[model samples]
Target chain A: MPKRACYAQDYTGLKILHTLYDSCLKAEIDFLDDHYLLNLIVDEGCIKGAIFLDSHTGEIIQINAKAVVLATGGYGGIYHGYTTNSYGSTGDGIAVVLRAGGAVSDLEFVQFHPTALKRSSILMSESARGEGGYLVNSEGERFIDELKPRDEVARAIFRQEQEGKEVFLDVRHLGEEKLMHLLPQEVALCKLHEHIDPAKALIPIKPVAHYSMGGIEVNSSLEVQGIQGCFAVGECANAKVHGANRLGGNSLLEITSLGRFAGDHAHQYTRSASNKEANSTQRDKDQKAIEAIYAQACTLNFYEKQQALGKLMYEKVGIQRENTQLLQAMEEVRAMQEMKEQMGIADKSPIHNQNLIEYLEFSSALLLAPMIISSALARNESRGAHYKIGFEKQDDKHFAKHHIIQWKREI
Target chain B: MTITILRSHNKQEEAYPLEDKERTLLKALTDIKATQDASLTFSAGCRASVCGTCAVRVNGKEQLACAYKVQDQDVIEPLQYHEVLRDLKVNKSLTKKTLQRSTAWLQTFQEASLTPKDEKFSEKQSDCILCDACYSACPVYAVNPDFLGPFALTRAYRYSSDKREADTKTLVDNVQSNGVWDCILCAECTLACPKGIDPKTDILMLRSLSIEQGYTDPTFVQQSFGFDPNAGF
Candidate 1:
């Protein structure tokens, strides 16, 4: 196969990031590193900049801008340990947008990659199976077609696990030379993390939460509806290009294509829009809310609650869903919100308080969980990633439309 | 298994217990954070090692926390010479500066063509994750903090070697001061790289290119003991 001179094997994403970061530096772009987005300030359907927490000094600062474009990535961290998402992928941006009355679509369609390494939840790429690898069960049988869509393979692996059978990605027959030449990253990951060489032993594998196909709704120009001068792009925005289950490589497509549109539209908006001072009332409200969270008594463990929520979402609202399980999941999610009053941070330092940051991320995840469950429950038929047990067929007649969720609206 | 972590707040090494399980060091740290202590702080992203946010020193060697397997009695610390943000977290704000200082990105362009061999040769140099493992490992920082370091020099080399670069001389000139010629050729950065990116060789290549471009080693010029104006007499 002919390879491009710039292609760096499986590290294309890293290479691109480095290249972009370098380009940004060359362009002399100012970067506020180690800052966390606290809240997006919107008043009268216009963006009024955003609130940020400086992680270095633990200071809340507001930067006023005419337009706000959120490229904050996805919300796959709700599955917690069973996800390939980073710990920071707690859907904070999406949750904040929802709180600001932004409509979110397809919140139920979380993509699950089928071959994440079992112990570590590190993703094993689809090329592993594409290279004639077999998805084998404990009985040494090929239970599911390895080349099926991501959702189907994930559901199949989930069913296998339910039957008390462990799944492994058997690629030993592909030979070591081929793996080294084609899938060096996968081979290296397996050798280092799992301690089992994929060329010799079966790689213990399972489905893991990977990508979120749902996010804050955006139009063709990547502008958020109902909110002027507010735009969302990348994984945080549902441009509707990825309808239910997104195809592989389309995330990058949306990123490059819609990302350009977002930049252009945001630039044009800022040209005509007038900047306003940060809303003092909303800033005070946000500050008081954070202070109240800090002042709460440490009775319930937030980590335990997060763990429980992750388990519930993974089991009920995960690959396979049903009416009763989703309802139970919603009830439990609501209960978590009620239980949030007793949770407080143990790390109260003024600098680099990761505990506070993670707790806030958990709060956002908790806020978004009910929406996901309700969205999953409202769409009765199994379509794409949302697989309900009784409603297994894709019913395009009634439930074919995207399930859009907004604040104070019924699912 | 017990993992000792250097806490940044008090500057003390604290030991945490981990259950005997098959897990990466990142997972163990996360487990400790979730169950044992909520105050434990570290930076991690893209747990499969694509994102280089989780690089840490395990028993005096740089390793990505998400890629290294957990071992008993492993002492983990933040990457050396960086301002520790918290426990096992260091500020990488200077990463962009390094790239800027080296003029790492393609500055000049020309219409050109490349062979498959050129792609194969450039593959190793382009895999840098900007994790700063090489920067943390390089002993050059102990002497000169302004040194452009490994990944930046490698990136400079990556662009200079490209056939599309119209002017590689300026990029080479940019790296002459605090950049390529100062490297001690220690190979520590190469050893520390998680992606197996050989920054030491890249720096050496940059040195040869610098020589080809009529650039002299600044250190050698400063310490020219045998230079005499009357040698021709």
Candidate 2:
């Protein structure tokens, strides 16, 4: 038995604190001198503006600011249950900009995490396998090579499951003592939730939808390609740093570094535009589109529709996809779009309802899903997470460049 | 196959033969129905560990009853640091209370400029499974029940780290007292966490952030620096 190290003992509490020790939260608490002058506005599209709705009664109030930045994250949540993104993410920033005639790129290429915790849908971070955890079968045989890349690992696991062998993560060698010290949360969950001691037993593992390797295509400056005053960063915006598969820990680097760069660039853009005012007619047009979206999203059956949309994506466009499934998913998305158009409106009272927000998110997912499936179908090569069993080989000859999906007039 | 179990209560070892090698714990107990009452108490659900209700102490270690492979001579007991409702079932109300005290819900601001990075900052920690392994593994909670503990502090950090949350000061103030700062930073919580969430780190981060925001351990500060600027002593 490996003697437990004390450094591994303080892993959970220390790791949790590392996440909270960011400059943003610190600046908000300690650095901000003028709390009164500080106007924190939500849903202002990355600008220092205020769109006020009355507290008790429904009313609209708007305020202008000197600068505007698009800090809206990536479009991963647009793929339903299969994303590493939080539930709040729905590609709202992407959709709003696209509607403003801003060209969108690389809407395809979603990255599916190879091994999510089987039953609970919790992400078993790749760091586990990366640190020497083995994938085993019911016969106690190590089925897949542990050192293989994520996409390969996912494919191998999927293949094994298809062959009727129940696969599990065998971290038993880590032992109860070390597991208790290093991965206490996971071990405890195994004992408590999954009813298995990771130290002594095999953890049931499966692949689930995770990070989107593709998003709104942006250049080096984090500017949305061919769109003025529009930028995206983080997982929502692909800066090409993640070529095919994103390296672990790169997400933090992308968000922090690219977010800062985009903010700076947006600040500069705002300064230059100080002399030249934004087109009033174009602003009015954008406002009308926003109003229309809000109106359509408030239907009584919107929540039901959103749930249906999630099911559709998870069932059809999930992990292993073929042309037949992709086509079927496209048809389902079309039907969902029609339903949204027909349901009209509900709750015109302008209350702070999350249902309406979810409905809007579902609409964005509905639009983005078909693009992902279609692109996945078109790219007849296996590279990264976009694996097509029908066309198995990684034919870099024809599929080297990134797949850019634009919203053409005709589907 | 005959198996023996040593009872901690009477210090008596009981043996009974089992029919199948792959027999479950429940089945084994059922086979030895003549020696003991058939109404023996334990917990099980899903028989796989996803439900988290079937944890018990086996052979002097905490193990999930569903996952643990029973042997010929293994002892069994209930979980510690909790009131046993019956044999193996612990009172879950304490963990639920910790969650309540932590206020793990989304705390939004009246107005705050949050970018994608700000929103994405604490996304990983938000996926807490609420399996109280960290609590059970916590030395502080075992010694002092009032230690706010790892799970609660991690949850507190989750909300406080959110850029959209308007009130970090209020959150910091709430955790300053009640053993939040008193954590010895032994990361047993990290080791016991199933979701790989590190509550120990969250607690430390909370302390550092709190101190930076002017919430200090006055005794420690005075002891270390011997400050008399404020009191004129």
Candidate 3:
């Protein structure tokens, strides 16, 4: 029997992650789950190692290492209710850096995908539009060109929905066989979750929170600025590789190419490094405070607060934003931050507890909200994915450089 | 509607009232965690079946929690053959061990001008999300955890069949012991795979490759006795 390899476009790029995971396994690299980096160990203005919480077993582990890479992805999940991010994309690394007084750039330029499954927020790839799929409003009119950049398309969709018009991806004319051959995964997802076949039906879609164009400020070697022996890559690093907006097929290219640069740099840093432990008093205090969460009485659930945050962000800071709306969004984030302490967890068990993890991620989300709003408010001009309706034109003269915010000792 | 979730750690079946109208198993379980109990643990990622982190046993079958719809009454638990880390989350440490045993990575990083043809050749097997559905469903592990299992074997075949690999002998050598041919061809893996990649066929192909290199199944014994030469049709 002759076997020909099939090459359907991997829209998610997750299958490649599996390959990398297998490679890591082959390399004998240890994967530690149920443990999160609580804080970056800082010594003599250099990142020494990290302090982590083994949430499963409820153990606080402090490791002294030579180099650390914060590839924990972007803060898309911080949008909470309507995002296309993984459950783990809570901006943990960014939050850690924020608390540690590390620098980050372009915290406000979040790229919202114009086409995502209406119910689940699962993204339908741009390849759909590339292959002649049209975006239709409730009146079945293609209001904007389907091939427009993400910001324009997302804004159009948002405006359509604001007018109470339902938006859909009309790929019915692509024909069934071609769709099945080219976008088998998209077809399967719609069929399984939406209970509709793209062959005969319109895929209900909306703008969903997708990628963070902002992240930990990194230099050419992908090392975090103002911090020694610490690196950031992928969506978590603001390399200006995507400029203001990310184009298709660039994320995979950027991460693979720059991740190597960071990895090689860190390897060189670690080769001649000696074991030196740093102060973890802050982490210890933070751990204690986090542990106290388990004992708190239930009041406002984290999920409800997260929904409120998501709704507030999508309305005020999302799709289209101006100074007044951004200021209000900042207020809402502040209010949410104030109320987060009252949010309680139901499961307090130390053994593989996801509730604690979610709560911790929620805390990270709380810290991240204001960062994005602050950056957005500071930049009075619009560029890339950061679009304020009033400031639609780019102001490279004044706002060309990065917006740096250090951690306030008091929130 | 209330959904009955079987907690593996406590060995208790608890029914939680549904709140989210999304009706996905992940949402329902998350609702339970948020409202009913905070201690309920499960691994979830992507929430779209793209990440294999949320694979669970729903109604005695393997399915991704984010992909599967919440049923009226369901017995949800952690996947089989893995040590239960907590509630619905299981320890995937063994999956790593088995993957290394199968030499699932490229034997050599020698450059190649791989085309769309090369990509198409290994496409089906490469769709593995490593959600461990096949690994959880494989009956071979019940008898022997040492058997390299489906995901790794399929990966071994994927890399070996790659046009870029200059040395497949290491991969073949890796799968020789407690791997490849040990798969009983149960076809449960095919059913369990959410991506619909057939590992039984991939394993069969690996066996053929092994045969080409003068290696047969360890159980293969020459039939020297009871040879009836004239009994053929």
Candidate 4:
């Protein structure tokens, strides 16, 4: 069971953040687009901006800011081919800290949303069920409670999919008028992408990568456990508020409330902090790091390897994981790490070099995959999103306490 | 399947044999980018169409690549009314910048006092993903590059109509000249919206609000409200 039956709700983060970004722009916040973070710049325990690959012009920029916030959403993109995450949610921030020897708790629990479009893995809002809808298997039977815990509902859907049954959300009873009135956005998305009319037809939905319940373990202050001057909130921080499973409706509330809390703390932290690092020195190191990536042998293709890694994670470390598959995932992650070294940059020219940015994303993903597999393996019990078929029971005696990986060694 | 992409650099169409699974145009384009040509570029995010970064010109029609299906011999090109950065990638910042000019931010944010009714009012306008499909499809942008365009005008309506607004006059006054009144309700923007957000309808609504505020346009009157068919000031 999840830590308290968290409220169930659906949200479009980008839409919510549209106003947030509007406010950010109003406050004269500078945005650096197309630049990918290579690594965090930590000097003597406090964070000092980051080193990034300028996607445009390919120069290495050393951003030594007062404070850094790791609100990079979740690592559901780690599932690769099957996920509802945007391409940029590569767990870059979390991966950086973990690689630099930091701690992250509950890293294994990845929440799979009950419904996603079967082909593209685009999200089908949970509001479909909440709005008096029903989930029926191929034979047209409501196999499970629509408003149950996400893990239970997702598992039900997944089990149905395994049994050679296509699962669908039947909202035809709601009629076109109510759907257009109450759930206009989901209706439009369904019609636009899937060509399904929610008012009349069955919307094909399957469990796919949705959210990472586990993140960089942050304390009450929302500061990263071992790392200094880095704050995390939203899906990137493990407050352990959502224990084994997150309640269906409470993700937005957690992020909105906790995100504001983190924002306040980060603001104060930045105000009290002073710039200490010399840019020239950091720039030289950043420049060297960028060159080193290009100087390495160009044998492995980062994009191909990344796609393979995503599919691999989806199969082995996905919704259902066992000891053997987890071990295989660990082995593959190690191999991918080797490939990351000799990653060949396709477009060396820094003018909007997506290749380099994607490579950086893949690097972060490779770093995260091993941690996720190991964390899932260490738990040895089915809890929340980390439900292994072999161990169906939630062993609260040993697994009740949160699992934290104190990453101290650089990978 | 063979896919034809209108390359931005040389302004030429390059054809490639589409390999692998049938996916969204954006996903297919991405696959082509990753394997076929590393330089092939386009902007996309939140493949769910909520982010609205994947707008492009498909068959010379503005469409969200993430939502548009790839067809055989389709002429895929960068979205119109924006500077093309790379293949199928056009700069839509101008559209977003104009939103600032239109004062799209909610000035009166009484979150606690806000009810579900207040939200339902601009529900359609709030659906703008800033994908710029409407902006790209706006023929007004073709004539007046500075036209505040569809999405921005729609956003103006979104913020202007918000009940918490202490005064919508500032928002109203912002979209006066090259903004709301400049919109040509050709319904192209309506057709382009992936979220089914009728920017045309929203623009017309803003025009109505403008008229209420004593703002007038000969084009709007002659086109929308019928300028008495014979009399005009």
Cα RMSD (Å) per model? 2.5, 14.9, 3.9, 4.1
lDDT (Cα) of model 4: 0.79
Report the lDDT tens digits of candidate 3 across residue range A185-266: 8999898778899999999999988999999988888888767889999998898899888887678878778888889999
Superposed Cα deviation of residue B132, candidate 4 (Å): 1.0
lDDT of 2 by residue, B1-233 (tens): 66665433354655656665664564455335323332233444334233455656666565555455667666666665766544444566666566545554445465668675664466446545454556777777667777777777887888788766788877787787764667888888787654557888888888888987888875477586755767875
- Candidate 4: Cα lDDT at A281: 57
Fnat of each prediction? 0.88, 0.00, 0.88, 0.50
Among all windows of ten consecutive residues in candidate 3 chain B, which has the lowest summed lDDT? B219-228
Q: In candidate 1, what are the lDDT values of residues B1-233, reduced to their tens digit?
A: 88899987688899998888777898888888878888899998788878889999999999999878889999999999888778888889875588888889888889988787877777788877788899899999999999999999999999999988899999999999888888999899999998889998998899999999998888888887878768968
**Candidate 4 deviant stretches above 4 angstroms:** A1-14, A191-195, A278-282, A409-411, B19-22, B109-118, B218-233
lDDT accuracy of residue A383 in candidate 3 = 89
User: Who wins the DockQ comparison?
Assistant: 1
Q: What DockQ does candidate 1 have relative to the true complex?
A: 0.78
Docking quality (DockQ) for each candidate: 0.78, 0.03, 0.67, 0.49
Candidate 4: clashing pairs of residues? A7-A249, A7-A250, A8-A248, A8-A249, A9-A249, A57-A350, A58-A350, A101-A407, A102-A407, A244-A384
lDDT of 3 at A68: 93
Task: State the iRMSD of every prediction, in order shown.
Answer: 1.3, 17.0, 1.7, 2.1
Model 3 lDDT, full chain set: 0.83
lDDT of 2 at B7: 35
- If both were scored by DockQ, which would come out higher, candidate 1 or candidate 2? 1
* Stretch of 10 with least lDDT, candidate 4 chain A: A1-10
**Given candidate 3, what's the lDDT at residue A184?**
87
Candidate 3 clashes: the total is 6
